[model samples]
Target: MTLTLRQPSMLTGMDIPSATQPTPEPAIHVRGLEKSYKDLRVLRGVDLDVARGSIVALLGSNGAGKTTMVRILATLLRADAGTARVNSLDVATRAADVRASISLTGQFAAVDEILTGRENLVLIARLRHLKDPGGIADDLLARFSLTEAGGRRVGTYSGGMRRRLDIAMSLIGNPPVVFLDEPTTGLDPQARLEVWQAVRELAAGGTTVLLTTQYLDEAEQLADRIAILHEGRIVVDGTLGELRRLLPPATVEYVEKQPTLEDVFLTLVGAGTEQGQR
Candidate 1:
């Protein structure tokens, strides 16, 4: 199948806001967030906000406090001095409520390798106390394109498939906010693209996502807003176009353009998929 990637025009089923209407509060809000390991400070008064139904990418290098920030926001870790709110509920004062509103996917797939893909999803659904776990599993399998391999052991699946299944399992109760902490860290190119598409679908379905990544291109491809964290603080935050404006405008040139490796890879992969279908 040919995959087309584009940002969603608006949130699913929401009408455009009228000019006179009050602005909606951000899905995530953080201010003066601070964390320390004895004398080693990890986060120093970092401030950030993520709009509802939008994807905000936290871009940082190794040891730049990206994971620290995510953990604080997800209610897995507490901040030393600051406030974080998810869906307008304070993550500190309402940790349980915050947990109920969000799902956290870590750097690695958290699937049970011995279990089949369907089994894993069903297990999560049952744990969440949802009705018809089998139906829930089937629906997510199809949603993430894992229907044919649903019966196969997760150990037999590829990296991308496992990650997709992990994400599908996280959507058991349709949590409005998702925290993806480097979800595509080690996947191959095609697998990375697969995860990217899955993330896009989340935003399209009105789920707010806060993605932490070291991949600059991943932010460009998926984030509605990009925030660069350096030395435990957000130094810059804006749309891709707005970030581009920070550099001097390009001079006019007549150099011939060439397709990037990504373009060539996707073209070949798409052609191969089409041939297989035929």
Candidate 2:
């Protein structure tokens, strides 16, 4: 199957105000964000800003506190120090309001295996007190391309399909800000691409997305800006092009032609075909 990669063009044709220029308010803002557990500190004086209608990828190794940061921003955990705001509401003081403006999909898929795909979405819509839960569920099912399997139990769905449904459930309330924690961790290449397309669509539709992923290529392809967290702090934050400048210049070299295993395999197959023709 052919896959057409989606480029990040959400910023195209838009006038990007300079850093010195006054700009619109950020969708997410954090300053001196600190979190600690007993003797160990998970986050130490972290600061970040995610613009509205853009995708920001937080890249870090395991245990670098990426999940911890997402939890705090999603109002699922409290910060030992510093402050975080989502949609301009304080995550600490206005936890309820912050939660109302954002949806969080954790590292694992949160779906009822026994329930049908449609049923899972409808349950969430009803929990959110939507007036037309069935209508909302149908719409999301269509959006995620799961309408054909809507009536099937989630246990019958593939890994990619289940992740898609999990993301659809997160959008039940139409929150402006969404947090995705290692969304495509264990997915195969094709499954990863499917999720990447979904994320691109989300950003194109003016939803602010903060995604945490260990996959460097995923970050390069999807994020308008990339932030690397190290040792419980942000070591660098910029666009892919800007980050590339930090590395040494590439050295171009030419090598003599040599027979590779692929070439040998193709040659053997061709020889067998010719001999059979005789």
Per-candidate TM-score against the hidden true structure: 0.88, 0.83
TM-score of 1: 0.88
lDDT of 1 by residue, 1-278 (tens): 01112222211223222234367678898999999989989999999999878999999999999998988888889899989988888999989878877889988899999999999998988887777888888888877878888998989888888898889887777777899999999987877888898899888777789999999999999999999999988999999999999999978999889998888988876522111111
Pull out the clashing pairs in model 2: none
Clashing pairs in model 1, backbone N/Cα/C closer than 3 A: none
Candidate 1 local lDDT, residue 105: 93
The lDDT, on a scale of 0 to 1, for candidate 1 is 0.83
Alpha carbon lDDT at 245, candidate 2: 90
